[model samples]
Target: MDLHKLYHVHDFHSRNFLDTYFSSKPDTPFSHETLMYPMEKFHNAFSTGDIKGEVLIDISLGPIIHHLYSAQEYFRDIILLKPTDHCIIEVKKWINSRTGAFDWSHASTFVTEMAGKSDQCEEKEIGLRSAITHVVKYDPNQENVTAPIELPQADCLVLWGVLDVISKDLDDFVGNFRRFSKLLKPGRCLMYYGALNGSFFVVGGERFHIVKYNESNLRSILSDEGYVIRHLEVSQRIIESDLIDFDSVLFCTAYKEQKI
Candidate 1:
């Protein structure tokens, strides 16, 4: 059974996906891993003042923007690329402050508190919203993921839980990485977050396929693609769940040494 095909056939409910894994409450292990962990990593990485750039390209799974709360402070412009219309609409809804948009106050509060600016929670959300200048749809299979309108080479690229979901095999993963690299300027940064050794994750009770690979595989791929790894952190799963099966979470920040 082609799991990728099944993923396209099913309607990916953006709201359901959020409620399942990214609830405002961080009581569950799933929320901790998916929401707080990434938030903390991004906060720490950007705090170094190394990842700041003029334009940041975000290619993440679903309509999730919790991880970008800190990034907005560093990047002048943010462009989001979504694979599905469902995801795109959800993002636009939030950008427009439309009805039924996912409340990201919890994420904003977390980031503000981390920066010792708990009183600036609303200011953080406003900054993120203003920084996100564009939300475009992209096709992962294409040679130019954002074709037709050539985007300026970004100073930083964020690939969060996207490669594993789109890649069918190890080779495909490498190819996707190369394609994504073209969007970033040489000597810039690429911040990646993904599940390590993950095969599947359930959203709206529908299991979606993810390419399983270990830390060594990811490290080799990044090195082969001419990226210099600066920071790599992996945390073992705190709890087991029927919704998703994975050994650990990996957060990496690397610089593109040269054009891939």
Candidate 2:
């Protein structure tokens, strides 16, 4: 790895991440886990120079905005949409990563935002003019409707973050996946990353239970939902200190199969 690149990456994390959230006052011992993997991948995509237009619809704050701020030329716009405002650390990540291109001319970018919980895409027509639109929504109750939740028709990449806690039952999760598959045309990719039900997490300063699913269960759910597994990335628990002891996290990308 180039030391210069690494240094910049570290600075982006420290100055932009820790300094903003943890504050530089008491020197809060903050670590980078959630944003590291995604940001590193973003850099990899840029290095290949194969990317064109990119639109990031982040669900877990806005780290994608941070990783590609000045380092990337592909993204024309970075819209900040949130379901809740508790995503302080995530917002900080965006602020730090957006140092460059903050004042760039986005008049022709065709980028915008939504400020509520549910993203009603299927009900509206945002057209297919954009290049990439990343969506992150995991709802079980609103299953198989095929309306309002359909994402924009662009070079789309839908992500399901924290899937384990989105629903009370596995069938609900599977149902949401099924409807999601219907919305996505064939050949597009969707990435789902979260801990299985056995996983633990801290939300609103309180620990709660999450629905767990192992690799086999995940495969079965996807297979039943009309998807073909294209790629898979799995990792052990990232933050397992005195605060939390979750088992692990899984990241998988699947394509909408041609056949139902």
Q: How many pairs of residues collide in model 2?
A: 8
Alpha-carbon TM-score of each model against the true structure? 0.95, 0.55
lDDT of 1 by residue, 103-145 (tens): 9898898899999999999888888999999998887778898
TM-score top scorer: 1
The digit string of per-residue lDDT tens for model 2 on 156-226 reads 34343434544445775676456445545566555566665454334233444455578889988888777
lDDT of 2 at 247: 64
Give Cα-based local distance difference scores for all models.
Answer: 0.88, 0.42
